[model samples]
Target chain A: AQKVTQAQTEISVVEKEDVTLDCVYETRDTTYYLFWYKQPPSGELVFLIRRNSFDEQNEISGRYSWNFQKSTSSFNFTITASQVVDSAVYFCALTPPIYNQGGKLIFGQGTELSVKP
Target chain B: EPEVTQTPSHQVTQMGQEVILRCVPISNHLYFYWYRQILGQKVEFLVSFYNNEISEKSEIFDDQFSVERPDGSNFTLKIRSTKLEDSAMYFCASSVTGIYNEQFFGPGTRLTVL
Candidate 1:
C-alpha cells in the first residue's frame, strides 16, 4: 500500500511570512512519482509540481519551493513571502510509475493554508 | 493552452436515480480519468480510460459505475444508481501521454445525491 500524509490540517500565516507544508509518503515501489496540487475556493485542482523517486534535488519556482528527501520519506513545500492569494488547500500525492499501474494518484489528507493580509 | 472541460457544473439527483457526468478532454490527449472528492476529503481516483476501455479502476469503482467514449471528443461516466454517499465533486482529467506526464484537470462537477 502507498500513502501520503500531510500532518498539518491548517496553517495561518501573515502576509510576507514564509510557511512550510510538510508531506510524508510510504511506497514499496522503487520508482514512483510525487505531486503537489492546489485547490482554490473555485473547486478546481491546479497542478503545482511533480517529483519522481530518483531525483532528490530541491526545486524552486519563483515563490514556491519543494524539498524532496528520500531518507526521511518527506517532500516538503515552502512558500516564500506568501500573500493573501496563496490561501487555499494544498495536497501532496503519490503514484506508481506509469508502466506499473494506471497512474492512480494516492493523495494526502491536505493542508489548508490561510494567508492573511 | 488547451484544457479539459466538463459539463453540468452542478447536478442534484435523488437516490436510486442514474446520472451521467460528461467531459471533453484536450484534443490531443490519449488518456482520460475520473476522480472524486467528498466534502473536506482528499481526492480519490475512480477509474482511468485508454484505448476506448478501462485501463485501471479503484475499489471505489464498482459494478454501478461505467465509463464510455461514445464520440471522438467526449468521455462520460455513468452511475447506474445514486446513493447518498455518492454525493461528491467529480473531476475529469486527461494526459497527452501516461508516462511521466502531468494530467490536466477540469473544473469538476458537483454531484449532490438527495
Candidate 2:
C-alpha cells in the first residue's frame, strides 16, 4: 500500500510570510518518487518538483524549496516570501517505479494555502 | 519547455452518455496517464498507457473506462455510460521515460454529468 499524508488541511499567511507544507508518505517499495503540485482556482495541477527516493538532497528553486528525509519518510515543501498569487491548494503525491507498480501517482488530500496581501 | 494539451476543456452530458476526453501528450514522451479529481478531493489515477497498450489501471478504471492512442499524436479516455459520480476534472500526463523523467500535466477537462 502506498499512501501520502499532508496533515495540514489549510494554512493562512500574509504576503511575504514563509509557509511550510508538511508531507509524510508510506510505501513498501524501496524505489519510488515523490512530487508536489499547485492547483489554483482554474483547477489545473501545476507540477512543482519531483524527488527520487535515493536522493535526499534538499533543493531550492528561488522562492520554493523542498526537504526530503528518507529516515522519517517525509517530504516537506516551503515557500519563502510568499505572495498573494501563491494562494492555492498544494498536493503531495507518490509514485512507485515500474519494478513495483505501473508508476501511477497517488496523491494526498492537499493543503489549501491562503496568502493574503 | 514542452507541455501537454487537452481538448474540450469542458463537457456536459446526461447520465448514461458516453464521453471521450482527448489529450495530446508531449511529442517525445513515451508514457501516458489519466487521472481525475472529484471536487474538493484528491487526484486519483485512472490508468496508464505505454507502447500502444495499457500498462496499469486502478480500481476506478472499470469496464466503463477505456483508453486509446488512436493516432501517433493523440491519447484519449472513453467513459462508456458515464454516471453522475463520473463528473469531475480529468487530467492527462506524460513522461519521457519510466525512471527519472518527471510527468507533465495538462489543464484538464471538466466533465459535468447531469
Candidate 3:
C-alpha cells in the first residue's frame, strides 16, 4: 500500500513567521513520486513541488523549501517568512511506480495553515 | 501558459438526478484525470483516462461513475445518480506524459447536492 501522512491537522502563525509542515509516506515500490499542493480559500489545488525517490537533495524556491529524506520516509516543506496569503491547506501526495500511467495520487489528510497579519 | 479549464463553476442538483461535469484539458496533453475533495476533506483520485479509455480508477469510482471524451477537446464525467456524498469539488487534471511530468489542474467545479 502507498500512503502519505500529514499529522498536523492545523497550525497558526503570525505574518513573517517561519513554519514547517511535515509529511511521512509509506510505499513498497523502489521508484515512486512525492508531491505537495496548496489549496487556497478559493478552493483550488495549486501545485507546489514534486520529488522522486532517487532525489534526496533539498529544493528551495523563493520563500518555500522542500527537504526530501528517503531514510526517514519523509518529504517536509518549510515556508520562510510566511505571509497571510499563505493561509491555505497543504497536501502531501504519493504516486505509484511508472507502470500505472503516473498512477493515482494518494494524498494525505492535509495540513491547514492559517497565517495571520 | 496553457491551463486546464472546467465549466459550471457551481452546480446544484437533486439527490437522485444525474449531473455531468465538463473539463477542457491543456492541448498537447495526452493523459487526463478526475479527482474530488469533500468539504474539509483530503483530495481523492477518481479515475485516469488515456487513449480514449480508462487506464486506472480508484475504489471510490464505482459503477455509478463514468467518464468520456465526447469530442476532440472536451472531457466529461457523468454521475448516474447524484448522492449527498457526491457533493464535492471536482477537479480535472492533465499531463503531457504520465510519468516524470506534473499534472496541471483546473479551477474545479463545485457540485452541491440538495
Candidate 4:
C-alpha cells in the first residue's frame, strides 16, 4: 500500500512571500511516482508536477518548485513570490510502479493555502 | 489543450434511485478513472478502466458500482442504489499509457443524494 501525508492542514501568507508545503510518502516499491496537484476555489484539480522516484533532482517551473528527497521520503512544493492566485488546496499523490494497471493516484488530505494581499 | 469532460455538473437524486455519470476522456488517452471526494474530505479512488475493461478498483467500488466504456468516446459510472453517503463530487480522469502518466481530471459532477 502507498500512503501520502501532507502535515500542514492550512497555511496563510502575505502576497510576495515564499511558502513551502510539506509532503511525506511511504511505499515499499522501489520505483514509484510523486505528484503535486492544485485545486482552486472553483473546485477543479490542476496538475502541477510529476517526479519519478529515480530522479531526485529538484525542479523549478516559473513560480513553482519541487524538491524530491529519497532519503527522507519527502516531496515538498514551494511557491516563490506567491500571488492571490496561488491560494488553493494543494495535494500530493503517489503511484506505485510495479502495477502498470490503470494509473491510480493515492492522494493526501491536501493543504489549504491562503494568500492575502 | 485536450482534457477530460464530464456531464451533468450537478445531479440531485432520491435515495435508492439509480444514477449514471458520464465522461469523455481525451481523444488519444487510453486509461480512465473515477474518483470522489466528500465535503472536507480527501479524494478517494473508486475505479480504473483500461482496454475496454476494468483494470483496477478500490474497496469502495462494490457491486453497487459499475463502469463501462459504452462506445468509442464515452465512459460511464452507474450506481445501483443511491445513498446519502454517496453524495459527493465525482471526478473522471484519463491518462496516456503508463502508470506514471499524469492524469487529467474533469471539473467533476456534484452528486446530491437526497
Q: DockQ values for all predictions?
A: 0.71, 0.64, 0.73, 0.81
Kindly list the per-residue Cα lDDT of model 3 for residues A31-91, writing each as its tens digit.
Answer: 9999999999998889999898998999999999999999999999999999999999999
Clashing pairs in 2: none
For candidate 1, write residues B1-114 as lDDT tens digits.
Answer: 799999999999999999999999999989899999999999999999989989999999999999999999999999999999999999999987764677889999999999
lDDT of 3 by residue, B1-114 (tens): 899999999999999999999999999999999999998999999999999999999999999999999999999999999999999999999988876788889999999999
Cα deviation at A106, candidate 4, in Å, is 0.2
TM-scores of chain A, one for each prediction: 0.97, 0.96, 0.98, 0.97
Q: How well does candidate 4 score on lDDT at residue A96?
A: 73
Count of clashing residue pairs in every prediction: 0, 0, 0, 0
**Model 4, chain B: what is the TM-score?**
0.98
TM-score of 2: 0.97
lDDT string, candidate 4, B21-91, tens digits: 99999999999999999988789999889888898899999999999999999999999999999999999
TM-score of 1: 0.98
For model 4, what is the C-alpha lDDT against the true structure? 0.94
Model 4 misplaced stretches (Cα beyond 4 Å): none
Worst 10 residues of 1 chain B by lDDT: B95-104
TM-score (0 to 1) of chain B, per candidate?
A: 0.98, 0.98, 0.98, 0.98
Give Cα distance to truth, residue A68, candidate 1, Å: 0.4
